[model samples]
Target: MKKILSFFSYVFHPMFISVYAVLLYFFLTDRYHSYQELFLIMIQIIILTILIPISMFYFLMTLGKANSLMLSEITQRKIPLAINAFLLYILITQSIREEVIPELYFFFFGALASTIITFLLIFVNLKASIHMIGISSITIFIIGFSLHTQVNHIYLVATFLLLTGIVATSRLSMKAHDGKELIAGFLVGVLPQIGLLSFWL
Candidate 1:
């Protein structure tokens, strides 16, 4: 359960999910859904998803733990933002290839917007809480819907209100987040999802 939860969490991550969405779109519309192609792409997606975040997190950890002036406490804000932006930029650029349709642009844009929103919410609160969790769902719905091509826009949108509530209860039990911070984090998670959905649907 722990591993499953972690995997799900990572899968929903804006950066990772963006990659999945791109790959899904590529395979879905290519008119070439051979098992061979899907297998190849699935490997590519898994590799990129695991590799990118692991690399970035390692760099961040090294810098932060090195106790270097580069990761100085005073400059923590600058570093996280800079690192996040760079990671986001690289991820989106790689995911939305030139060969793909322009609608892919909406997906990337959703990523950007979500990153911005999440950072802002994080600044507002350090901990995740029920409200933050709920906001994330709402955000996811909005982003998904924004894409304008989502197969089940309504279902995705509804997940916000429904899943958010359940997640909120779970968080409460785990004591992972306080109310205010949780709400903020939820919004942060959700806003990008909404942006992404809008890009598609």
Candidate 2:
């Protein structure tokens, strides 16, 4: 049981959420994007969102500024979140332009807003569940994508809803977050996505 819970935590870690969102966006959209274009976009996402963050994490770990990938401490979250926000800003402004792919563009925009909010909460010594934030943000984005594209992605939505509960439980079991932090993370994750729906959806 412990191993399984830990597995979900790592599998749904915040660092990989952007890649998941982009993959899902491509999966569900009927729009035609060339294989080369999709491959390049994916490569960009992997480099910026995953590879860069992992490298930064190792650097911070070497400096004794971060101990783990989970970033279990509020103090540890500051730098990573700030870097993530900057990366997301670059992704939206330079790579995924709104005119090119409005859905993904707005998705990153919402993610940036959520990252900034989470970063701000750290000053007050509040540690919301970043796991919850990641899962919830992607879940709501999936929901919004379904509505906007008029695709019957009910099964996908249901799967993520289930994953959301599993992730919340996983965090609780790991003692990484209390109920309030999880709820706060959920709100922080969803509100921006919901608010930005008008621009794309």
Candidate 3:
């Protein structure tokens, strides 16, 4: 049971949320973007959100700044969160343009907003579960995307809802966060996506 819960944590780590969201967006949309274009976008997202962050995490670990990939410590979160926000800013402004992919653009925009809020919350000594934030954000994005595209993705949404519960349970079982932190993270993750729905949804 412990090993299974731990697997969920790694599988749904916050670092991979953007890629998952992007892939799901492509899957659900009937957009006319070519395979080549979609491939390029995926490469860009992987490089920025995954590759760079992983490299930085290693460097931070070597420097004794970050102890784990989970960034379980509040102080360890600052630099990574800042880097994430900057990268997300770059992604939205330069790569995922609203003119081209409005839905994805707003999805990432909402992601950026959530990242900033989570980072700000650090100052107040609050450590909301990044796991919860990541899972919930993508879950809400999936919901919003379904509505915007008018696709009946009820099963997909239900699957994510189940995954959200699994993630929450995993975090709690691992002693990574309390219920309050999970709730806080869930709210932070969903609110921005919900708020940004008017623009593209």
TM-score to native of every candidate shown: 0.55, 0.98, 0.98
- Highest lDDT scorer: 2
Off by over 4 Å in 2: none
lDDT of 3 by residue, 110-189 (tens): 88998899999999999989899899989988888888888899999999999999999999999989898899999999
Q: What TM-score would candidate 3 get against the native?
A: 0.98
Model 2 residue 21 lDDT score: 92
Error of 2 at 93 (Å): 0.7
* Whole-model Cα lDDT of every candidate shown, in order: 0.50, 0.93, 0.92
Candidate 1 overall lDDT versus native: 0.50
Worst 10 residues of 2 by lDDT: 123-132
| Candidate 2 lDDT for residue 198 | 91
TM-score, prediction 2: 0.98
The residue-by-residue lDDT of candidate 2 on 1-201, one tens digit each, is: 978988999999988898899889888998998889889999999999999999999999999999998898789999999999999999999999999999999988998999999999998888988899899999999999889889889999999999999999999999999999999999999899899999998
